[model samples]
Target: MARRRQAARAAPEPIRATSMWRVDQVFLTRKGQRVEVICSLVNDRSGLRNLSVIAPTEDPREAVRHAARFIAGKGNVSTARNARVRWTREQSTTLQDELVRDEQLEDDFQDEFEDMLAAVRDQMR
Candidate 1:
């Protein structure tokens, strides 16, 4: 029994590294009926909860590393603040794979702005 106990103690435990505070496995409800969605509904899953991002291009692992280093009082103080945004495994590919604009968009609002103003002004008269 001593040998068995020692062997059991020697066995390594599984490690699950994650920052997920909580995850609610929700189901679809429509017209008082519960629907078990089977297909990989990518669009439906993409949202602010765990799926949203500040800088979608940035790697969450780097942020984790930065936060860890800051928490340990080794890295720069700004490291934790700068590396604020974190993404789960579900958000990684969806964000990384998508194309994001880097340039400033042209202001075409002026075209409709005058028309809308005029219409509003006319409505008030």
Candidate 2:
């Protein structure tokens, strides 16, 4: 007697949420002799609706880059496919005030950023 064979099953694909990000404003604030760069990021797809990056740098470009990297490194990729980066002259006082009030809750993610860079370097090698 011949035996019947079972068919192979395919694996299910992973669900990925693409994040759409908008960089609304990039402003500078001076504290004593040092200048701080603040960038506002808005994401409607994920829970990170409104996010801000405060970098103690004189260059606004650097601060914006940091914000992009932060979004990528922090798993905020749900709507990253359609990223809009625009500089607006108007600053958001509400966000700035919130940042100042919650200074203790601020996280730079420097170590995580470094690790991500290292991983990419390793992959290239």
Candidate 3:
């Protein structure tokens, strides 16, 4: 009975599938003629450290994808562990909007923006 109890106690507990990092916000910003996607992450373990990703693009979907990829690629090596992306409906809308009416000037410089995105992608790699 003692040996059985000791063996049972030594058994490992099942791991829970919980995200250690949460995506706090996903927003867009205008930089010169290009639109950039920014993602804010919070470490669930301590909720003190944060991570941010900035991807240059005209499309919000691409921005989210880039951010996700960056997180998957870097999250493990960093202080973050098992991080997952989470955002509200309003934040999702931000990713869906390709062109904000208020940023009319940004609409005029499409080619330049694409070039900038390409350069940023290259640098990221």
Candidate 4:
């Protein structure tokens, strides 16, 4: 009877598992005329972090404005007419992996306390 009760109290799988990355901060980077995206992240249970993807032709300032708009909660990124920066969950994970492999993220940025996506979002205004 005790064993059965204990089994019922066991934690779920999601609680046991560690995350790959948490999309925290997003700011644009420029390489001369080219534009790239630097997605700051918190790499769970591993080293290295950061994502850089070439998104040229997109004005860097415009990209920041779009991201800021989403973070500011002024518009929706999901609605058909709400087109902005878009990436799938799978793609986000892939970008996290790429950044980790390249050691692009800084240790300072890895600090979970400073890397809250919510904090960044709130500051978008």
TM-score of each: 0.17, 0.36, 0.38, 0.31
Q: Output the number of the TM-score-best candidate.
A: 3
Off by over 4 Å in 3: 1-19, 77-125
Sort every candidate by lDDT, greatest first. Answer: 3, 2, 4, 1
Error of 1 at 44 (Å): 42
lDDT of 3 by residue, 1-125 (tens): 98888977766766656545544444555455444544455654545434455567755456555655565454332322222233334434676543333232223222333444455557779
Which pairs of residues collide in candidate 1?
none
Question: Could you give candidate 1's per-residue lDDT for residues 8-116 as a string of tens digits?
Answer: 7766755544221211221111212221111111212242232211221233333222223223231111111111222223433676533332111101112222344
Tens digits of per-residue lDDT for model 2 on 19-63? Answer: 555443334454444444444556564333455556556554555
Candidate 2 stretches greater than 4 Å from native = 1-48, 89-125
lDDT of 1 at 97: 30
> Root-mean-square deviation of each candidate, in angstroms?
20.4, 11.6, 10.8, 12.1
Give the total clashing residue pairs for model 2. 6
Model 2 misses residue 2 by how many Å? Answer: 56
Candidate 1 yields a Cα-based lDDT of 0.26
**Candidate lDDT (C-alpha), each:** 0.26, 0.44, 0.46, 0.42
lDDT of 4 by residue, 1-125 (tens): 98999889957656534444545555455555755555554545443455556654356554443433333242211111111233333434576643432112223223322334445556766
lDDT value, candidate 2, whole model: 0.44
